[model samples]
Target: MDTASPAKWVPHPEGPEIAFFDTETTVPSRKGESYSLLEFGAILVCPKRLVEVFSYSTLIKPADLNAISVTSVRCNGISRESVGSAPTFADVADTVYAILHGRVWAGHNIVRFDCPRIKEAYAEIGRPAPEPKGLIDTLPLLTQRFGRRAGNMKMASLATYFGLGRQSHRSLDDVRMNLEVVKYCATVLFLEASLPDVLSAATPIDELPITRTDTDITTSSNETSVLVAHIEEMKLDSSNAGTAPSYTTVPIIEGSSGFSGYLEPEEVMTQHITVSTLPFGQFAKMAVYHKDVPLHLCCANLNVCFGVSTKFLDNAGRPKLNIVVEIPENLCKVLDKCDEVAHKMSQEAGSISQWRPLVKKDGYVNLPTVRLHIPTVANGDHAIYSTEMYQKESSGNIQKLVFTKVDASELDTLFIPGNMLDAFFDLDVYDYQQNAGIRLVAKRLVLHSK
Candidate 1:
């Protein structure tokens, strides 16, 4: 509650440091409810050593005590009674500003959540918010770097993955946990990076047989499919409907072979559907199969029930774009079987994440629908649409649209709800954090002429 800055303490004179911070806020229980800062905590650390040099935490009373609902207290255990006597944000504004201003900032989900909370706290006080020298939001950073072994990649989940004990959800306790989580992740990555080199030196690469089935990522007309193309292999193409074309890249085609055999939904047999694991543990892939063959199915002419959405985000802060479509009974049975098999496989693989079914029937008057993911590929430091995009004219010729840059909002204008289109997609199964389900990844989208 003290606004006074303690005497200076600098522990890393030879290296740069980052301020790892966290905030506890009022969770809006009602519509139009604004978040009020409940607590603030921060720790300064040397980036090179990942050692903390200073720490600060304090509770602040919000102007409106009524904002603290039972739901908010249950979320973080911070009640109005506890903060009633605590200093208001205005009291500790000086200390908070000094601790955060002009330094590199880092924390779990700081970019999307905490940073905005900080800005709002300052804005409410009619004061300019402190600016960081640089930013490092670990939510996106770890997602891109560490992979999703720790489940949804939240602070609590990461802590549980490392057996670091339960997260208290209090500001200072959470901030400290955030630092430890990053430290553990860095250690794991370091060890993993070194292993390949050590093993290579000890054993010649040529001597070891590569028994792992290589998932061919190329969806181009060359071969059809791979074992199950790694999501990042950015290319596109699809062969004519028959001939068992799979998702391929570079003119990324819809082939019966994209990855693990992209078959038509019409060709799938529910009784033959099953799930199998790829090589590697938590970071590995899963395959849905029809009898002995991998079941990566494609269907054409699905009606666009809903257009592009950006509600969920990816590692780089862009929307994890997808469109909703009305599906036929055949595709529904196929997807349901795939979902059933995949859910069981994830359970056998020891995942407790909530299962997300690709098919939806409840919200739309019991009409079945499936989502089609529109993915992106890295192009130097940026990403371009990975789904080969095209527009079919009313006259009947289909033409491709080339883009220099792209985003979810811009793509929104293209896939209008109720529009009819032919879609080619990969039925991808995934278990991340605590969410497991099959993803209908679109490889090629041919828009119908208006």
Candidate 2:
């Protein structure tokens, strides 16, 4: 995939139409090579009934014809000869813009792949890329609400699962398949929801999927996607300073600085730390505790060494948002001790997964840095940041930021490299599929104004 940052979208008019689109690009032959746009196709559909309103498809010739490789032809069958007589992207930018701009853009995997190509295509022509009013990425949307029922959740697999026919690997065909797959999935979910108990069994564990003993895709935990309201932002008025900690047990962890219930690492004693196992039905969870209370730390003025990263993704293709920050020795000492104790406890608990260190030494200078995960949970048809965020002005005034939309671009803006923040986080230990580690899960972040 291309390493170029995807373009951030600007607001568009609130139109009744939703644009379902796809792009076919040349497959890069080597690392750091970018994709060359070959074809673009889109269909304008009514948001209410999802019926087609307008359609457009065109082949775009790349500046360098040699960019089209044999591998690229095998992937999408867009040959250099096929597009040699076609209009270049610059020649057809106006048509593409008219078809896409100011609509709710919907596509599969476009967030990671096609969006950047579109932006770069416009940039190459020294033109502005058309922006969407909102986005509806069918990839994460289906994966979250529909689960892995259709296997890898790709358009091809989903089309096959629904007997919708083979994917053409062309831009126009793929977009149509994406919409049909969504419709079929939605219909099944609607029928299942009407008879919830009989169609799906109720289990004590909500997060755990209800499935057969064998590996069939049918699952009872089908969550319906709801209508999304407008994205609204609100600044939190005040922190509940005297209130109890949300993540920890009673005997609140108090601090004068930052938010309540977030303790500085200097206030933590290495000797007081212990890992305990708590039973949850048939499973047990290992947790780090300071004496008896669950341990969490808050550190101010941590410099960001690396910005928000979406390179790592969950099984469902959801971006695992995280950032790397340089840590102070005081914080490092406390975390190192915690890692040692937690790794031992995880092994004792019969976790066969390999242990990954929490504190990492990067570069030849060996600076101690830690990655703080900003987790995401499902909303109506999208994923939103689970971490609470606040912005602290140079004047020392802090206001919390509340986001209802699923845009990860906002994170790229806030968590730029070299920015400073006060981090309040907890240790989340997990052993899944032979990989295990204590993840520093951020609960609240107060971004400092430069």
Backbone clash pairs for candidate 2 read none
> What TM-score does each of the candidates earn?
0.46, 0.46
Backbone clash total for model 2 is 0
Report the lDDT of model 1 for residue 7: 23
Best by lDDT: 2
lDDT of 2 at 397: 57
Question: What are the per-residue Cα lDDT tens digits for candidate 1 across 1-450?
Answer: 222233244233223557778888875533235678898888876554455678878888999999897657867899999898888898878777877887777776565467767887888889998877666666646655666565556677777776667889888888877766665565556445569656322353343322212142112322122211211121111111111112222332335223345677777778888787787664688888788876666665665666677679788876788898877778888888888888888888888899987889985625688889998777888778888777654334555667666555446545644345777777788877877898889888876542
lDDT of 2 by residue, 163-232 (tens): 7677898887788777777766776666567788766423233344332322432223222122111111
Q: Mark the regions of model 1 whose C-alpha exceeds 4 Å error after superposition.
A: 1-16, 197-450
lDDT of prediction 1: 0.67
Off by over 4 Å in 2: 1-14, 201-450
Task: For each of the candidates, give the backbone clash count.
Answer: 37, 0
CA lDDT scores, all candidates in order = 0.67, 0.70
Q: Cα deviation in Å at residue 126, candidate 1?
A: 1.2
lDDT of 2 at 3: 9
